[model samples]
Target chain A: MGNPAFDILSILPFAVACSFGMLILLLEVFQRQTASRSYLAGIAVVGFLLTAFVSGSFLPTGTARATFGGMAWIDGYTQIFTSLFCLAGALTAMIAPRYLQEHGADRGEFYALLLFSVAGMIMMVAAADLVVFFVALEIMSIAVYALAAYTRRSKLSSEAGFKYFVLGAFASAILLYGIALVYGATGTTNLAAIGQAFGGDVARGATGDAAAMSTLAQNAIVAAARGADVSVAAVIGNTGAGAVPLAILGATLILIAFSFKIAAVPFHMWAPDAYTGAPTPVVGFMAAAVKAAGVAALFRVVSVALFSDSFRGGEYGWVQIFFALALLSMVVGNLVALVQGNIKRMLAYSSVAHAGYMLVAFTAVGFRGGDISMGSGLVFYLFAYTIATIGAFGVLSWLGSRGMPCDNFEDLDGVGYRYPWIGLAMSIFMLSAAGIPPAAGFIGKFLVFKSAVAASAAGGPGSGLLIFLVVTGILVSVAGVYYYLRVIVHLYMKKATREVPEMPYGAARWAIVICAVLTLALGVLPGKLVNSSEQAVGQMAGRADGVYQQSAEAPLPTPGGIRLIR
Target chain B: MAETIFFIVFALGALGFSAAVLIAKNPINSAVMLVCSFFCLAGIYVMLSATFMAVIQILVYAGAIMVLFIFVLMLLNIRDDEIEAPRLSIHQGIAILAGTGIFFTIALSIAAWSGSSSRVAHDTMSDTFGTVEPIGDQLITSYVLPFEMAAILLLVGIVGAVVVAKKRF
Candidate 1:
């Protein structure tokens, strides 16, 4: 309402993505029909790189300021995730042209939709309002639904698309309903405003100290009563007489929607079909960028808006739900993945298990235990997982280009000796996915586990829960090894039962090489990434403001204290 | 007293037509019943003082979208033999039970819940709150971003339809 140009740079990533998407659409129309698909993909790559560069610039600043009338937060957390998403988009663009052309669905709309989805992801990471977040989510979901069904000629693809669209639409509706309920309870859609309402007078007092936090338990009820028009006594007694249950119910419903997006078990039934039927490159994009976007959105909501210490003490809580989902996702995703013969389906299930690992970090953050940073570990883990997934799917796409999709394990028999480089790239990706030592996956897991252990040691609420998750996570890693190594064994040990096609030189090959090298580098020298992640998470936590940063907004009460953002 | 009698009659008609929509054997009959249901619902909206919404209910749902539904039905033109006989399964029974349970729970809560009536009272509200001009003003201002985004979404939908349904691209 003030300056039209105020903080316009905050939206650079989204603006870049949107403009590029439209540019690609226009280019498709104006350019010759026979213009190389790779050229179009190259434009997309340039767009992503530009967006990444813009987001990356904010990393050094490490600011957590709100912009767009507080509808978006320009912060280190969003910036880093923005980079992760852009890198995924760039890689997808690099690998997609070949896959789309091979499948006879090469069209300008594919790249356009990819960019649009990427734009949506960018918007999601930056969104600070429920309305904005929901719109961004739909933007991403709709584009992805089309991408999943891009191969209209294939029945399997159409079915996958239809299933994903219907289910995704239902999830969106539920999410919207939850948003409506929360808005009803809190009377605001802005995360900051909601946090302030939840925090009440304690939040406004703005004294940064441990003593202030001791009073938080007592004051929190008063705050909830004031904010939500519910009685403090009723809330403390858990009599279900007020908006507390309604807020929790709303949050839980939203969490259910997020669980569906992250492919947590019980909500992960659609992933196998969608991932298997989608083109190889598009599946990789879904695994990497789409999952990252979902996690980003989930983290923002749970941490910034709905976070409250008292919410956990009640019979109904988000923490318990997260803990249960994490354990189930880990065990079920791994055990069921072990039985899958289709490689894409296996990877899809593997993505679910990976989501479980990130959820462990999410749970720890929600517990607000220890000195461990909140979102950095989750961000790093997603980054590492994205790299490995992209590389793995790149190998599949390479084979797909040669007219052999390698959909099932049998199709990859003896491919190792015949195509050693692709075999080697795929092996690294598998090893990384397995969380083996000296791979990016292991480093990501290490950081995540370290945070969980730290949280447990902090001797706060849910310590035992965090400890149990860490132990189970370690055990699940062993199970992960067997499935991942099985793929490697199929590569080297099994002789060629089917004719191994010659490895072609193209964007997919380059993408695989880049991703493999990046993954290995992340594993071997994770110091920089780890430091950056910690810094980003610390900034998100508001530690940079010399106050404890909990999941809530800056102007709201942290578990330890209140730090005003001025 | 007259308004109350009219309300009960309209509500019953809405419910009956809705049931007919669900229970009709022929697709054309179902479509007609759905139109009747929509009109009855619009009547309820008007009684509730949401005249704009009531008008929109008829214009959009009954007038435009229903035409599209009938056109598709006519285009398909499946023979009576082609339609499968309806059969109730355990799954359907469970779903119906769950739906009814939810409905009762909501109804009971509304009946039982107290102390929020003062908040629900909007007698102090602006006269133009639900009118067309205020809504248009807000849509062009506060909701401008979403409005633009929705436009882009529709454009994407058009592009998607072209790509998905076009025979030769």
Candidate 2:
């Protein structure tokens, strides 16, 4: 019953964040009521910095391994995402003290919940088992729900919390059900096992592919193919036809669940209200870190389980579903954002559009074996998005007070001239978000678009789809310019409507300056970062083959009460 | 013939109780009907020879959860007339259509997969696998992490309840 100390080292970042959170929560009770809350913020900042350092240290030097009986993984992908989440958490912590003081909701649990949620996000990225992933997702979601309602004084905050909880629970149920069905088909919940279950000739010998398989399986596969506009007859004619039906059905269910998490077009309805109603710093955390975790999970799950080699080059595939979702999200998100009056809501729609761009990159990976640069592009884009968004929200948090939050377009009128520093930073964020030159967002978008073009020009089976997405994505990004430029115009041209105190700030101001500088720096000198990102992705590509080798050596449990004795 | 009759009775009872829970205007009636439905579900579980699951179902769903439901219902003291029937609208109509479509699609998909060798066979179960002792052993051994996580989740639930329901710390 002793602890597995050696194995636990792989999860050092998660452990650090969780223990730091518990320490903060315990100290909150013993500390004097009159004590400055900034100390707690300082602890959170240290925790995040330490976690980021640990994650960075563990980045793949050329190896990838799953520990804890395949429940968690240590790899370059996990390292990159872990660092991003911790950095986001740190930045949010820096902004929270000022925002909470102005809003009259300063409490220790706020920082505790933020750290706990960051731990959950790190765990999510490291998860190698479906159950671990589900647990981590729930932990993150529950803390966020609590944080959303942290302000007891505001009815809007409570409403936002309740709505998000109800919708999130519904989505979680759908996702768990999908996991159950997949477990049913594959007889295992381990990502590698599920991947092996459906890949190549191995699937024919899998438990579910026996001659006694029901005709209904064929019917469902046909229905799925028809739904995706693929030829059902051609798919049924293939070898391992019996396994395809269940894989298709399970993947569809999982795709639906992931769509909600990523806030794709139709599932994005709750995002605006959730973002606008929460405290500004929490909104930034959710917008940046939460979105990063979701995207990472999507990539891991799709590549590790759902898109095995046998499922490729098929008449029907999950890629087509993702392609459709990405196309709709880009078109709808950009178009609707143009009319939003609330800054938070506009940013929410923009987040959805950004998810679309990432999905386009993800779908393109289905073509040409696996595009390492495209995958790395996704990581880079998310990092850029996180910094810019946190900065934008930080500026909003700075300008707002308890009674009169500067949320609307008119609220920001002439404030730019009044606070030149904040105005210039906000302008930089707006430019980055619009994919304008000399900004990180532009570089991010260029890399993603370039990947899509590479996939289409590679002349694969799904090249046409990638081509269409790339074209539409580029055009929609141009439309994204309109709303972003409008923010700039309002900041500079409009007259100031109200007078506000111009007081020197502490941590929040410093945080905003750091974010802006990083955004600009990454844009101006992208070489080193881009090279690291591609290297991380290269490590990922090599790791897939490594996983198969490891699984071969391990004793694998098969379906039908069969076990391999090594 | 006897097995078929038994299955039909259990299915009908469960479905009827579920329908009653949905249709009952009063919250108390709905709670009662839900308890009845849980019993029927436990019966179905027993029919599948998952005796441990059936016992847990009765203990957790029918007993403990129902008591909590009744406690909340009594505490709220909502008036009977306040629970009015929802009027049919375009939104409702579309929801119904979508629900039916999704249900049929899932049912068809499940039927196809089940007909194949994918149907998990309970007939081959090891005697100890379904028994209480082995289940307990496995819960403490292989599933110890999940069990501990569940304990933490319950603790969180308690803390959250205290934080939200209390007017002041």
DockQ of all models, two decimals each: 0.20, 0.30
The most accurate candidate by DockQ is 2
| Stretches of candidate 2 exceeding 4 Å from the true structure | A1-6, A58-60, A200-244, A369-373, A498-505, A541-566, B1-6, B118-123, B136-163
Model 2 chain A: weakest 10-residue lDDT segment is: A557-566
Write down the TM-score of every candidate.
Answer: 0.86, 0.89
Put down candidate 1 lDDT per residue, B1-169, tens digits, no spaces.
9889989988999999999998898999999999999999998987766677888999999999999999999999978999999789999999899889856754453333222212323343345545566556545543444555566566566666666666654
**Model 2 chain B worst lDDT window (10 residues):** B116-125
* Model 2: DockQ vs. true structure: 0.30
Question: How far is B76's C-alpha from truth in model 2 (Å)?
Answer: 2.8
Expressed as tens digits, the lDDT of each residue in B50-96 for candidate 2 is: 67888999999999999999999999999867777789999999999
Kindly report which residue stretches of model 1 are placed more than 4 angstroms away from their true locations once superposed.
A1-7, A31-35, A58-60, A196-241, A312-315, A369-372, A401-403, A460-462, A497-505, A541-566, B1-19, B32-59, B88-117
TM-score of chain A of each: 0.87, 0.89
